[model samples]
Target: WKQSHDKDNTNRIKNSTENTSTICVSVCVFLQTILVGDSGVGKTSLLVQFDQGKFIPGSFSATVGIGFTNKVVTLDEVKVKLQIWDTAGQERFRSVTHAYYRDAHALLLLYDITNKSSFDNIRAWLTEIHEYTQSDVVIMLLGNKADMSSERAIRREEGERLAREYSVPFMETSAMTGVNVELAFTAVARELQQRSVQQPSEPRFQIHEYIDAQKEKSSCCRVF
Candidate 1:
């Protein structure tokens, strides 16, 4: 289901923190997130909608190169400034676009619900993400254009299934109507915050090796 936007929901990402410590120091964490998908999946729209709270309608031109924006958000009471990189989705820009994935804290693999081919290409994007980004980077599968239900070619179950298979968070959003845009952004923030707590150090998260007896692939993501 498409989630309605409540501007108050932006408070999920607040800058103000409660004073508890005698030496009350402010919290500041920076999370680097990358957005990648097919050419017409509304990636730029999603970013614009979340950052400015206004939807730009009509056929917007594709992002020529990498685009950038940042917003301060609070997740789990921890303040984070999310540096969002919106990468060009065309094949011509793949060489430069995928390079920035390195050292990223989170990745948003987006697909258009109205386009089946866009959803089909998600695995390829996932492959690129695994190749370039940290193995432990928080991944979220976003099926955009939820408001375009009449034209939707991909079912919600399909999105949920893929998300479960890869153990990534999943949400559908409508950049045009501002549906679930805040929730989708904040969910990734909360995930990265929790992961940071579990992994105190930097990018390299220690993943457990699969037992020799188990013939199946590692539930944990790693190149074979």
Candidate 2:
């Protein structure tokens, strides 16, 4: 009788674990992720490659204000929809870009590997992020255009050192060759998902408010 009772308890525990897993898989989460960088740093191209899986060669008429795209990523059996905004890199649009920072859950800060000035300006961008976004915002530093090895101005070690100084994750990506583009976004999404699960009661920005505000400004671009 004792052995039979033990087996019954084990079966019940297994069933309970399965039920918990099922609940976790059913969870759907939305995360507001944004990309910020200097103009000509390939921020838009990175977003395009991640969303559409293709690279647009040559120059893209720099995003004037802000444009966004949505992609669903699954992390730990949870569905996370990433609302990724591509902010204008030009100085004139800094204010416009800053306004969206408060509600962002994660940010990808990019700098051109071939441009030393762009890398140098990372401090300014980090300052703005601290000023505008919440303290817990997840940020990743990316050195883009890794494919241009011969023209590389920023060494990989330098990127790693800067990231360590700021205490943020760092990676080198090539939007032209689609290297680590997907991984970069996925890494951000995974972190966001984990944070949401851990802080279930955290106050969240209403999606409706974002939609209403976007309607007022027709400059927002939606890629799909």
Number of the predicted model whose TM-score against the real structure is largest = 2
Q: Candidate 1 at 122: error in angstroms?
A: 0.7
- Compared with the true structure, what per-residue lDDT tens digits does model 2 show for residues 155-218? 9999989998998888788888887787788777766675666665866543233323433553
Give the alpha carbon lDDT tens digit for every residue of 94-203 in model 1: 87677678868888889999999999999989888888888778888889999888988999999989988887767788888877677677767766666667654655
Q: Report each candidate's C-alpha RMSD, comma-separated, in the order given.
A: 12.1, 18.8
What lDDT score belongs to each candidate, Candidate 1 first? Answer: 0.75, 0.81
Runs with alpha carbons beyond 4 Å of true place in candidate 2 = 1-27, 199-224
lDDT agreement of model 1 with the native = 0.75
What lDDT score is found at residue 151 in candidate 1?
88
Clashes of each: 1, 0
TM-score of each: 0.75, 0.76
